[model samples]
Target: MHILFLHSNYPAQFGEIAANLVAQHGDRCTFVNERVSGDQQGVKCVTYRPASGATKQTHFCAATFENQIWRSHAAAESVAQLFRSNGALAHDRPDLIVAHSGFVSALFLKEVLPEVPVVGYFEYFYHRYNSDFDFRSDLPPQSELSAMRLQARNAMLLLDLHHCEAGYCPTDFQREQIPAEYQPKLQTIFDGINTDFWKRDASLSESHATQRMVAGVTIQPYEKVVTYVSRGFESMRGSDQFLKVADQVCKKRSDVRVIVVGEDRIAYGGDARFTDGKTFRQWVIDNNDLDLSRIHFVGRVSREELIRVFSVSDAHLYWTVPFVLSWSMLNAMSCSCPVIASNTAPVQEMVRNGQNGLLVDFFDIERWVECVLQTLESPPETQRMGSNARQTIEQNYCLTSCLDKMRSLYQNVRMR
Candidate 1:
């Protein structure tokens, strides 16, 4: 079987699946992406670039959709070039195309290879309210133009959903955001975690673990380490609340250390609404009375370093509004860290209160502080919860199970 994978960023969420298929089936798998960073182990990668650039004159509302169309056109042209038998390099057509939905690459592929089945990765469906933008109370008020742009961004998403044979969302909470009629064609499959690599290391001890430290802060086994990770220090992930509670915790406890892993930039939503010219991290520092020495803001670390932090942490703090889930939370769970997460749809889907981990209200800084204190105070209970958290990931969100589901989806679409 010949499978083609499409993503604007090379191997976005489809990396594991694409690599697995290539390993199992050898040269039958190919990846077409907008990036040509390097080579993969057993897959052929073809790169594409937008034929036209977004001009300054492009209307703000239509700019996003126009850029998506440019990506679709460029990817379609690259795929067409591969099929030209007269070209220097000719490749056979794919049996199936798997792509990220919002880019509209798969939609254009349908026009080129009309008979082939395309599986779209439906990550999220934007909305004017009740979505990422309005989930937080701290965000600045939205304008009519901003709301219109948000609606306009979904133009390609709706079209992709209509044309694709099947779509997969990482969580059912996300799948519910799509139109009800399209829900049947969508399946829930998590972007699974590698439990073997992320598991707790029993051999790691205070004496030996000092060799590798997070941002040069050596964590002693006697001190309780609390960790918070996100793609960025932004409002959607509740970075503000986390920092406020971190300040509170630091003032109350002497033996606790806070390690935050993320950049100061905003990954989602508007910028820091309170500050005139400050990053979110800078704003948090300027407004709050936090102990600079107790908190370590390690911008971002490698995968191995993250696993190390998760392994040694006594408690992991994951706060977010009712938005898309972060893989950082799941990865922490997989590493058996006692997680204190916000009670949102995505977090609630994976974490059960008093079972695997503890959940708290997103806005309640007191409850968040209490939960972290509880985890730090109770050693046996924290270890038990960590054990349960690892078990949860192993049972439901492991790599093997998710890949099996993906393969089944592929077969179902191919047979149809």
Candidate 2:
């Protein structure tokens, strides 16, 4: 079988699936994206660039939609050129196409490969109210123009939703956000975690405390470690709340240390608007009375180093609004790290309070501090929760199980 994968970034949601197909099933795979920067062994890589994007004069609400249309046109032309280079042969065409729906990369593919079945990976469907935009009360009220832009953002997504033969959402929380008419065509399947690589190293915890160091940060013999991971330090992931909680916990307990992993930028949300000419990380530091010496901001580290960090942590803090769940949280769980997460819809789907891990209301900073302290003081309970956390991932979100489902979906869609 020949499969063609499409996404704005290479080897994102499609990486493991493509690799599995080639290594296990002896399938030929090709990946097309705007940027190709990863190890593409056993797969062909193609890159495309938009001819033009929306100009400054373009209406604010339609700017995103305009850029997506240009991207769709560019991607379609790239695939057409690939076929022409192959002498336009029927067998050269792929048996199926898997695309990420957010960028509408496959919107115009039907014109070139009309008979091929395309499966869309729908990540999120935005809403002006009752979603990420309005979830935080600290932010200013949404303007009419902002609401219009949120609605316009879905224009291309809606187009791809109807154009594809089938689609999938990484979680049920994300799937339920789509319009009711299109829900039946979508499946909820998580981009699985590689438990084999992410599992905890028991030796790390038993090592001499003075010799314990990960990603250049050392752990003292008398201190307890708390870990927080995200792609960015932004309010969408509750970076501010986490810092505030960290300050209180550190103040209450002299033996606690915090390790934050991620860059100091806003990955989501309009947090910059409130930062007053400062990065959100700096803004939070300016406003809070935090213990700078105790908190270690290790920007980003390799996966192996991250696993080591999780192995030594007494608690892992994860907080978010009602938005797309972060893979870092699941990875920590896979490492058997005791997680204390926000009680939002997406987090609730994975964490069962007091069973697998603990849950706290997003705004309840006191409760967050309490949970951290609880994990540190009760070593037996914390270890039990960590063990259960690993079991949860192996049962539902393991990489092998998810790849099997993906292969089944591909075969089913092709038959149709």
Top model number, lDDT: 2
Q: Could you estimate the TM-score for every candidate? A: 0.94, 0.97
Give the clashing pairs for model 2: none
Query: Tens digits of per-residue lDDT for model 1 on 278-374?
Result: 8877887787776768889888888888887887788999987767888899999998999999988889999999999999999999998898998
Q: Indicate the TM-score of model 2.
A: 0.97
The CA lDDT of each predicted structure is 0.83, 0.90
- Which ranges of candidate 1 are over 4 A from the true structure? 25-27, 86-91, 205-212, 272-274
RMSD of each: 2.1, 1.3
Q: Pick the candidate with the highest TM-score.
A: 2
